[model samples]
Target: MAELSEQTGVAQSTIRSLIRGRLKRLDSISTGKLAQFFQCKLDELYVMKWE
Candidate 1:
C-alpha cells in the first residue's frame, strides 16, 4: 500500500478507506489516479450497486 501510494501519489489512508469500504464517495481525479496506477480503465476502478 505504501509503495502504491508513493507510485500513484495517492495517500495510503485514502486507499485503505476505499479498500475497507469506508468511503461514501470518491472524486473523479482520485479515481483516475487509482485507475492509472492499477493500469486499468477509469470505469473499472469501481463498481456501483443500487440499494
Candidate 2:
C-alpha cells in the first residue's frame, strides 16, 4: 500500500482506507492514479459501473 501511495501520489491513509474497504466511492482522477500504479484498466478497479 505504501508503494501504491508513493507511485500514485495518493496519501497513505487514503490507500489504507481503500484496502480496508472503508471508501465507498472515489473520484475518477484518484481511480485513474490507482489503476496506473497497478498497471490495470480503470474498469478493473470497480465492481459496479459508474455513470
Candidate 3:
C-alpha cells in the first residue's frame, strides 16, 4: 500500500480503506483515475462480491 500510494500519490490509508471495503461507493472521476492508474477496466475497480 505504501508503495502504491507513493507511486500514485494517493494516501495509503485511502487505498487500504477501499480494499477493506470501508469506502463502499466510488465517484466517476475516481473510478476513471483508479482504472487508469491500475491499467485495468473500470469494472475491475468496483467491488463485485464484497468479501
Candidate 4:
C-alpha cells in the first residue's frame, strides 16, 4: 500500500477509503493515476451506479 501510494502519488488514507468504499465521489486525477499505475482504464477501476 505504501509502495503504491508512493508510486501513484496518492495518499494511503485515500486508497484505504477507496478500498473500504467510503468515497462518495471519485477524484479524476487521483483515479487516473491509479489506473495508469495499474495499467488499466479508469472505468475498470470503479463503476458508477445511478441512485
Candidate 5:
C-alpha cells in the first residue's frame, strides 16, 4: 500500500480506501496513475475481499 501511494504520489489513506473497496469514487487522473503504478488493470485494484 505504501509502495502504491509512493508510486502514484497519492495519499496512503486514499489507497487504503480503494484497496478496501470503500472509496465512493475515483478521480480519473489518479486512477490512471495507479494503473500505471501497479502495471495491472485499473479494476483489479479494488478487490472485494482482502487477500
Candidate 6:
C-alpha cells in the first residue's frame, strides 16, 4: 500500500480509507492516478451497485 501510494502520488490515508470502505467519494484525479498505476480503465477502479 505504501508503495502504491508513492507510485500513484495518492496519500496512504486515502488508499486506506478506500480499502476500509470508508471513502464516500473518489475525485477524478486520484481515480485516474490509481487506474493508471494499475494499468486499467477509470471505470474499472470501482463498482456501481443499485441501492
**Which candidate leads the pack in TM-score?**
4
**Model 1 TM-score relative to the real fold:** 0.68
lDDT score, candidate 3, position 23: 75
Question: Which is the winner by TM-score between candidate 1 and candidate 6?
Answer: 6
lDDT of each: 0.75, 0.73, 0.67, 0.79, 0.76, 0.78
User: Could you estimate the TM-score for every candidate?
Assistant: 0.68, 0.66, 0.60, 0.71, 0.70, 0.70
Candidate 4 runs further than 4 Å off? 46-51
Each candidate structure's count of clashing pairs = 0, 0, 0, 0, 0, 0
Order of quality (lDDT): 4, 6, 5, 1, 2, 3
lDDT, residue 39, model 5: 86
Instruction: Write the residue-wise lDDT of candidate 4 on 1-51 in tens digits.
Output: 999999999999998887667874568989888888989864655654222
lDDT of 6 at 42: 42
CA-only RMSD, every prediction: 3.6, 4.5, 2.8, 3.9, 2.6, 3.4
Model 1, position 27, has a per-residue lDDT of 81
> Which TM-score value belongs to model 3?
0.60
- Candidate 1, residue 29: Cα displacement in angstroms equals 1.4
For residues 1-51, write the lDDT of model 5, one tens digit per residue: 778788788889988887667885779888788878878766765553443
Better of 1 and 5 by TM-score: 5
Cα distance off (Å), candidate 4, residue 19: 0.8
Clashing pairs in 6: none
Error in Å for residue 44 of model 4 = 2.6
Residue 37 C-alpha lDDT in model 6: 91
Model 5 regions more than 4 Å off: 47-51
Per-residue C-alpha lDDT of model 2 across residues 1-51, encoded as one tens digit per residue = 777788898889987777666786668788778877878774555543342
